[model samples]
Target: MTVHTAPAPAATMFDVRNPGTGDVVGQYPVHGEPEVAAAVERAREAAVWWDGIGFDERRKRLDAFRGVIARRINQLAGVIHEEMGKPHGDAYLEVALVLDHLAWAAKNAGKVLGKRKAHAGPLNANLGATVEHKALGVVGVIGPWNYPVFTPMGSIVYALAAGNTIVFKPSEYTPGVGAWLVDAFSQVVPEHPVMQLVTGDGSTGAALCRAGVDKVAFTGSTATAKRVMATCAETLTPIVAECGGKDALLVDQDADLEAAADAAVWGGIANAGQSCIGVERIYVHTAVHDAFEAMLADRVGALRAGADSGALVGPITMPSQVEIIRRHVADAVASGGRIVAGSGSIDGQVVQPVLLADVPEDAAAVREETFGPTLTLRRVEDMDEAVRLTNASRYHLAASVFSKHHGTAIADRIRSGMVAVNSVFSFAVVASIPFGGVGDSGFGRIHGEEGLREFCYAHSVVRQKFASPLPLMSFGRTAKVEERLGTIIALVHGSK
Candidate 1:
């Protein structure tokens, strides 16, 4: 007779707390390697079915999924506000953007990734070629908490639309929001676990990278991205890392100061300045520096960060971020940076908006990713200096240029991935454009046609239409045939 041993205990559990209040919003398991592996295996099976359904059928399912999210948008928004400390209205707005992107991804995936004929060169006229994008099997989405519903969906929705199943590992700080999203999708497509949620911290994320998923799409701090990259390297797994940014906004002498100031304030302080694309640095032409400063000061001063329902700004979602904000402000002031408006202090997790001026270019607040409700302003001699300073940052993520006549011209000069002319972060809302950055801001894209293709591998097909008299691919070709092929290549390419 054999004795049966008791099963191992379940994984450790953790609590997700509201940043505004110290209250526990929800509790979830810290999924380990075993659970993550299981999720990946399940996703692999689901991906087979998901991808086999063909683009038209997949589009229908995605449309239904989008409808689910739209119908209970408020519910998801509530979860976002509770888990991440964004204002209720702001949370709603974030979900609205997600809905638009989801709809676009669903409607356009077939057109973007469908098989299409590719013209064969004259030398290969006997062959017919076509190109198609095939799903990567399964995708592991490691999401961020700042815009829980919007940011991850950029990868999740597009990957799903491309016919890949997903194993989403949301930020531990906002696991409840992740749960809600998965639940919503299940309501529509309950046949299989097309979208699964694995809740935990960095270990869980690492497990995902190593669990043999087709690809991992991550969004978080640049430092953390490096770690994730290293983990993915262990498995030779590819990843799309959407990291942090110290984005800038440029103001020209001819800009509409009123519009520029309003956009800057919203771009820098909304969501308590947690956005990766948020404007943290501003370079203004000296001609309108004073006027613009005054306008910005008035706007920032009127804004407050609080836990109240009507407050425009909310508390810092991650407690550790408060210290970073505090340090940046203190360092700026110590380096002779003056607070033009609002106080540079932290009351618990609530950091009042601070507009700093005269900070040195090398100051931590200026050079670093100060993910806080603060903006550093500097006056430049001209638009030349404005563009120079804007491109100097190591984080070439995104930027905004404000000029009545030269907005596009100035935007084209910036080294970032995308720029908005006379506006802030507008490129993100447009469904056709890609969203990403160069350098430390991370690689790969998350929106538009590029985004849908990001989750797929190109599949090329070539069919021989007829036997070629001069076949280059056969080993039995005669020397005369090779000489003729060489002559053809020289004729086609040597002149160019």
Candidate 2:
């Protein structure tokens, strides 16, 4: 990893360490209050240059940024691997997915938010009407460490494509990756600080919310998101919060256990199971629970977490996360849940896959988001019961359903904002679909057309083709005009 000389009066003082070795990989400038405030203030000015360039010009710049990302994909991935401790392949995949989102956002921003004519209503028939989406100035983004590139890039690239400058605060755990992204973007648009970085701890993130940015897009835990929202609320800044999810996977009686096991293991244990949309709960049909558990256990037991190619998963990305994983495991075992395989713990940071069965609904393992290399297996009477248990959480981010007959129906009923019917998180990978949740999981959206719109506001325009003798909006309105307006409204909207 490249190390720049530590600057005096460091704006940011974040430490980056390899999760597996506990070795200090790097130290980043933890952008402070004044610096972050300056960045946002600067981005506001940059927003003018970025937005004034127009859509076509912005597309050209975005395409250039894409070339930068593509050219240094592996180099960027190496930084990600060193910072977040994920497998090299996983890191590459994360950046690759982000490349797709960048391309989609730049290509489709115009169509999704362009001006369109609309009915002025019968009351205003004399005037024409249209609405066009406009950029929302400077946007601040707080990102997570897991999928460090893909998740944050979802907001940063889309915001940039929408003609808004971005000041991003990536998770301190992966500040290096965030810094790398902002630096690369600068190469494409070197004239302005259109994309800037704020590196620090939670307080730095709070500083961002308090900054005068137009909107804040935060992706993290529900608890932290609440704090971030409250901070942003002081200024009434609109925010898009993508919080945690204790997502579940339901298996119908006629479903395939082998395929379900494959998805469950991949979704739950991949990235060391740190995914917000990762499968933490599994509700298998009672008749098939045993077979399904056996298959899941066999698959999970074979998998290992290491920095080597022989193992599929890497270590826990955060040191604090290891304890959280251990707590959830111990809690589940103490609550009468049986560990079917791999109890947990390893040399430095590796955590072996664990499968828990008979986990009580009241246990933290079942309700809370463990966000680790663990899975809770349960059996329900039918799909109805499965849906009931799935929607029991305060979070509704993402979910997965495995069923031969009722996958779509079950998925539709679940309250999550996104779902993968026969797969895991396929919705997020598809650049056209929106990814976000409602309720405690937070509001607004990112990715696809929705992601682009979140960074902008609609501007309506109305022009009259020809003036009517009867203008209700003016003081010239008379009894005859009122009667005529009522008649026109009734004719157009009443029985018709």
- Highest TM-score: give the candidate number: 1
User: What C-alpha lDDT values do all the predictions have?
Assistant: 0.91, 0.87
Residue-level lDDT for 482 in candidate 1: 91
- Taking the tens digit of each residue's C-alpha lDDT, what string does model 1 give over 61-108? 878888888888888889999988999999999999887888899889
Q: What TM-scores do the predictions have?
A: 0.97, 0.95
TM-score of 2: 0.95
Kindly list the per-residue Cα lDDT of model 2 for residues 1-496, writing each as its tens digit: 2221112265436578988777898887766678788888888887899999888888888889889989999999999999888888888888888877888888999888888889987666688999989999999999999989988888888898999999888898898888788877777788888888877889889888998999999999999888998999999999998989999999998887789899999999999999998999999999898889889989988988887767788998877778888888888899999999876765567888899999899998888888888999998999899999999888898899998888998899999899898789799889988999978878899998989999999899888878886777788789999998788879888896
Q: What is the lDDT of residue 378 in candidate 2?
A: 93
Highest-scoring model, lDDT? 1
lDDT of 1 at 291: 98
- Native-vs-model 2 lDDT? 0.87
